[model samples]
Target chain A: MIRTAFFVSGRTAITAEILGHSLITQFDDVNFRRIVLPFIDTEEKALQAVAQIKAQAEADQCRPVVFSTFISENLRKLFVMDEALTLDFFETFIGPLEKELERQSSHTAGKVHAISNFEEYKHRIDAVNFATTHDDGGMAKNLQDADVILVGVSRSGKTPTCLYLALQYGIKAANYPFTPEDFADHRLPKPLHPFRNKLIGITIEPQRLSQIRQSRKPDSQYAQLSTCEQEVKLAESLMQHERIPFLNTTRLSIEELSTTIMLKAGLKRRCY
Target chain B: MIRTAFFVSGRTAITAEILGHSLITQFDDVNFRRIVLPFIDTEEKALQAVAQIKAQAEADQCRPVVFSTFISENLRKLFVMDEALTLDFFETFIGPLEKELERQSSHTAGKVHAISNFEEYKHRIDAVNFATTHDDGGMAKNLQDADVILVGVSRSGKTPTCLYLALQYGIKAANYPFTPEDFADHRLPKPLHPFRNKLIGITIEPQRLSQIRQSRKPDSQYAQLSTCEQEVKLAESLMQHERIPFLNTTRLSIEELSTTIMLKAGLKRRCY
Candidate 1:
């Protein structure tokens, strides 16, 4: 296998790896070593990255692939003489957009990953707080404030999906757990009655939920497959009885689950 | 404000909105109504999007700005005849990378945001589990497997930062709470003493901490500025005394805080 060293010029390695992965991972027989260049903020940092890249290339016997989300033209110029396969994010999108919009590009690095707009940033922070505080039916009193309240059994991917909704869309997502007693109640839970419009019931395959529970609590009654099946069936019946909008978490990823939740709830994202 | 409509062709509106937000939001005195194109999977979906765009344009009396992260060339061709300033993601980066890497682009829509790599995807799910379970020392008993542990006073942003690190980088991050009592010890908490090397202390300014606490527990003793001040000072000194790496989260965003934490700890991203 051909080993490829990867050098990224950004404050963090996230952007470079995200855009690069979908593109680069398709290449067969190539092992990628992702090295986030130390102190990549200015012209001096750019030179330091180059020096490190040069040393890595000599050791590896192959030119490193440089993926840049760097915005400044000054910073991009420093890498022009470097011998590497460069994928520049700003150079690719900015020029065309500047001409198209008839405006100047901001050329700001880490725009997507950074807090470029403090309002949107704060929205995310608030959403995080809301999701965490309202998690696992922790604060039933706070349910009415939630934009969307996710209801499901414990260990059924509720917490992660709610957190994703918070982080990605700045949606105030709260989740409530259905216990054995709550599941036995033929009627809807009393706490969830007032905000039934906000309730979106989540269910999962018994096997999957069992496996998840077993991972957390091995060989316990909670981890039993029979218990999972009974709970999931009861939850589904309750959702139908209550006429609640429901979704299956058996196959959906967290992002997909959050999107579908928003779509079903008809909730608008507070911030992008 | 002029009413301008917009269309994006992708599996999800998320990537389109995220990359488009920073660049598009800068335009002053213009209102944008972004319409995500109807399922762009076939020729019919393309025609549906065109019809919707046409109706929206007619209603708004302005030519729209179209941003396509649509991967298929066939689908892209359908938009070529449309009258709008198109911002294409594939046409920009794929050509250069194709030439440099000597591989054809996958041309798949939503590859980056979707479950392109299952291993990386599973890492995120597991990291999220690790983060939620170990949050605020809830599962301090399970700290042996954590890649890193975050310690901070209440409302100093430990939970959100840990979650961000988990979601973004797939790092197994656990956060421990430090009360005034623990901080008075002038060293790491007893439970965290074993994982001292894995510790990354987090601090926030007293004013910011007070504001955050006030929002959570309004008018409470925890929201008092003096309490915040005393707690923060002790935490910072404890970190210094133990030679533990720390960062102030008052001005830093979640992205910046996670990046700084990783850099200070010399931690590599466990997954993308």
Candidate 2:
């Protein structure tokens, strides 16, 4: 069994934890013991953490792996000096950035060149705000302001895609629910009727949707396999009649969904 | 006026654009003369992309930066063979991840971990569902289910934090507006009456809030200096009365806010 320790120092411990989790998920078929050294803010604290890990490793008769994301250089250097610690996975933001600057020395125009696409960045922020405010069940009058409307059944990953588009691309995305009532009526949601051209549908494989719903409402009628299939089929049929462009959200992550939506909606990519 | 080019390839073109925008943000100076490359799948297409980037860089008399996320290994090797074009900056996911994994081998357990607190991850997913059902208006009934409830004036970065927690930690976070009505009454939002303990308030420097708000609603009363000051003072005072824990979101990124909220709310860190 290998022993590992994560040394985190930042204004927030949660960031460290999230990063730590992401890192650990990569390892497979290993008996791993883990420890978190949170709030190691000072160089002294970092050195102490190294010493502790070294002593623990010696006691256990195994070298301990130490991963750190501390911003302090002094702390980082102290850990680097420790021979017992076999690894230091520190995420340093400035080093690569500085190298890029030095390489582009002759072409350095100023910060304005760096932010040539500021307007697009601003628009992405606006899009996220628009999507957040114009969510389903709101007043009908607000729907007119939507640039693109997303309609989907529950557990179809609509909300996340909308937020991503808004936060990242600055598109005005509004999502409306395709409920039993809409399916039964063989039409889009009432609020989405006026903006049919801008309407985009999201669908997922019924089994996947069922599994997602099952986690939240196990053994419920709404989460039944048959019910999920029915809703998906009905929603797809309705979308076909309405001539709405749709994307499958089953295999795609939120990032992919947002990108597809932006491309299909003819919205200019803001960030690039 | 040095000319530069960026060769980008990914699963989607928009992702390449967003990444390009992020890279531009990192550089303080430099003029990117043009960006060349296509968004394509398959190794053959990727090699074609490499050839195009090499030719462009040579013509421009500059070593272009090639930025890619997911491309074939054959294409990666092809780019490496060319010394004139600096293909090192290609932002492929695997290279850095592999480096991190190898670096991690000598450390704790030699596993690259996903950084996240797991409980917070579960809570974030719940928060997405909760946020969908309850917006600023439905804060009361949904307050009970929230792992951490955030309340603040507009542009306090409440929604982003809530969404980040939901997406990253799968926490069910709900947010309520500390609107003028709530402030005048010197109480939490009507919906938050029953679950005061779960409530957390977000505060920001009035000036910063005003600046952010001004971007959305320039010259509006809501974005005015005095108006922001009044709203902040009232919101903080009301939070104090309700005995809700609060954090200042002024300088904290979305990552920081979500993490801090997780810690303060006593949610177990899930990923680390």
Candidate 3:
């Protein structure tokens, strides 16, 4: 079955989408087409959103499910429609939170997305620049500034994981690839030796690594399964010999890898 | 006063953190020390998390707030503690969702982080690679493959926005900086002429742009206020003459800029 869902919010609607997605995905039987209504902080915008949702529901011949994070009580009521199912995040949780915390919510609109803390925001932007500059062993002189350095075979999901850590968490992540020369021996790379405590090794299963490499470069020695197996085995052996903690990215998503890396490395997330 | 909060989940606690952070931030009076306990998929791990929360609560002499997305009923019960205020996202929302949809939720654990859609995952990886290669006007010959091209003066928040769009939304974004040469003339650069339809202009206020540039290259002509004003004025005028839709990124976060760019370009997000 196809269902229409609206993720409504007074701000960016990102929180609404995250909460809504986590809930709606549980109903695996229905395919949901999500529409995001962001920046609807006023009564007029709320009314327009209601009309839009009602029209969409009527056109689809189904009651549209709305998941909202609107903070204003008056604006939240405007979204109440007889033809649609509306679930307000703040309404459901805020009262209970107030009781527990012994204070009412500030009820501020769009504060979550504001760049209120310039220092923290600037740190995140600087971290992004750092990750980009140090990506794939691009620069080693500034390795000391990195919060975490990722060591892995090429195409073992290093770049994206580093970037995610940098952008999402304000983590200064740098990555280095194990080349053919490095696989000849068990010694850590000279540049990485000084930052042993910050190193997190990432390895992938040979078959998966081969498939990934094959997509990038077809019919090459670099993409052969035998070469991949040899490199991965040697990489694992080196990491074990050096007592470097490692993760297998064979069956993990980037988010999983980054989160696990943060935990394993004991790195603090500089931003929320 | 400072309070402790735990964002716990069976998978990556990203959703938990997003929801928890959004709610916790509304109470501006109290400072929060946020901790993420992710990959708590087992009963033993859940028990350990509960013990950890209890210990922290006792140490603080205050009850901690626990926000969880544990889909398993058995595991969810393990998190309830007298010393903690628990908010289970799935427990709170899934029942109502099931009742509304007239269906039972799968109640599966950690299904959201699974890389079940390989094609979609691969596309995101490819988009990230594309954005990296084309960052800062590095590559322009393959502009045809770009889903969106961002044009702006240096440090106007183009590279990070492109990377965010690529990693977060699976949009192939390429960025080009408008150099002093481009400012000398009102015409769009030659390479950008072919893909004007895919172009989205980004502008920043002169003072903000000057501040950003000053940090990067102190005491240089590039960082001078007059230079920033001239470049911004020229860029905005040129964009207006070319009828390119633009956004001011001075007050916008990278997430906001990327989302707005996606909307302005009418580009369909290739992945969620």
Candidate 4:
């Protein structure tokens, strides 16, 4: 049995959980207890965490494991005074990082992702706006401004990838769903032709594509496995003909797809 | 005159950039050189990083500020061999964390945000599918399954927030655009009544809303400031009347807004 605790100087729930979830997968049959200590900017609050850990240790007959992202050394030291074990993410990493970056860590809190830089936040909003407007490539007539234009058959992971790129990287990504007409003619969509250099084609296995479309339009010709197979085949040929870099998203997550697209297209991210 | 550098064991670009950007804003005169050393799962790669850091140090005529997130102590020691200053995110923090969790650090790579667990990844995709199918509310018409329903005027940050909740947390979020007809009556549309318990209202400042709408529909009545102001006011009143938890997205970013909604509504995230 294991008792895992999370403590941070700021709202470290997101960061801690991200690491914990991965760790949990590796070790099964472990009892997990998350002791979240947020806003521990002072030594007093830190000692309070010590008390909680001590209490848990007494009850469990063993020391609890603590994962922390606290920015303050003094506050972290208070936790170290307790019987519980610790994983001090900030203190452990900051010194070497100071050397690597040629500067000292600011030891700042709440800057992990949100409310840190207004400029970066605004850039994300603008990217989302751009993505929403240019979605399906029909709403926005201006394709030249896009950082990357994602082309794919309907429901081939274009829209979600575009949204991920916009929300995560703040890149001006626009997605155009290739209709059957475009597939038959063996050409890129009309508006997308000018932005061929920025095009990234996304396709899925025909079986998976059919599964997705079947949920949307059951018993329809559009949802037929044959139609899905045909569209995917044509889209891949179109991408090859145009020399556009494409990825099959059947097994890849959106993060993988977007990162690969970012590398392939060399699209600079505006924000994190 | 400051030449800052970054190094990490895992893919630390996202984490490094988040902290680095905040540090950059604090010190505007510094130069940054990000040297990402991903896949440092072995001792060989870690030594290669030492070589790269040494070259940069000699060329720049100054010791570089090194920020590292390497999870291995043996590999991290290789960097200490180099002339660059160091801040070790992983090594500095892992011992205490091991104590906290009562277990040793796993030192896993390629799992920070992606490819950690396929089940979690699948949940996120399913949430995205649920969100896209349920987007605009009218499209899905199945409100009972939604983890949360977002009601707001057009371009009030509803769609993007829904996507964010879906992609990031794997929460089944759906959004509805409150139309002019709903605004005229100063009430939520009839369709949203059944899912009142799952509703989270999002509104933006009229000025910001107008700005966003203007980009989508230039010089239209929908994009007018007056229209924005009126809709926002009516939406707020309707939220008040219905006792829905609402947020003003003008100052808050999408992440912040969605997080607050998740907390207020007590929605358990399906995935990380």
Docking quality (DockQ) for each candidate:
0.40, 0.26, 0.74, 0.31
- Model 4, span B138-234: residue lDDT tens: 5646888889999988888787788899988889899998888887877778877788899888888899888877876899999999989988888
Error of 4 at B199 (Å): 1.9
Q: Give the TM-score of candidate 4.
A: 0.80
**Cα lDDT for residue A43, candidate 1:** 76
Off by over 4 Å in 1: A1-7, A26-31, A58-60, A116-119, A180-186, B1-9, B25-39, B56-62, B116-122
The 0-to-1 C-alpha lDDT of every candidate, in the order given, reads: 0.76, 0.63, 0.89, 0.72
- Report the first chain's TM-score for all candidates: 0.89, 0.67, 0.96, 0.83
Q: Estimate each model's TM-score.
A: 0.89, 0.73, 0.97, 0.80
Residue-wise C-alpha lDDT for candidate 4, range A1-272, written one tens digit per residue: 76655544455345555544445433344667655455565667677767878888898887766666666666777777456666655655555445544566666655554554656766787887778778776565788888989888998878778889999888989999888888787877777767778888898899988877777689989889999999888888888988888888887767767767876776767775
Top model by lDDT, which number? Answer: 3
lDDT of 1 at A233: 90
Worst-scoring 10-residue span by lDDT in model 3 chain B: B109-118
lDDT of 2 by residue, B148-222 (tens): 778889878777667666665567677788888778878666667777788888999999888888998899999
If ranked by TM-score, best first, what sequence of candidates would result? Answer: 3, 1, 4, 2
- Model 1 chain A: weakest 10-residue lDDT segment is A22-31
Per-residue lDDT of model 3, residues B160-212, tens digit only:
88989988889999999998899787888899999999999999999988888
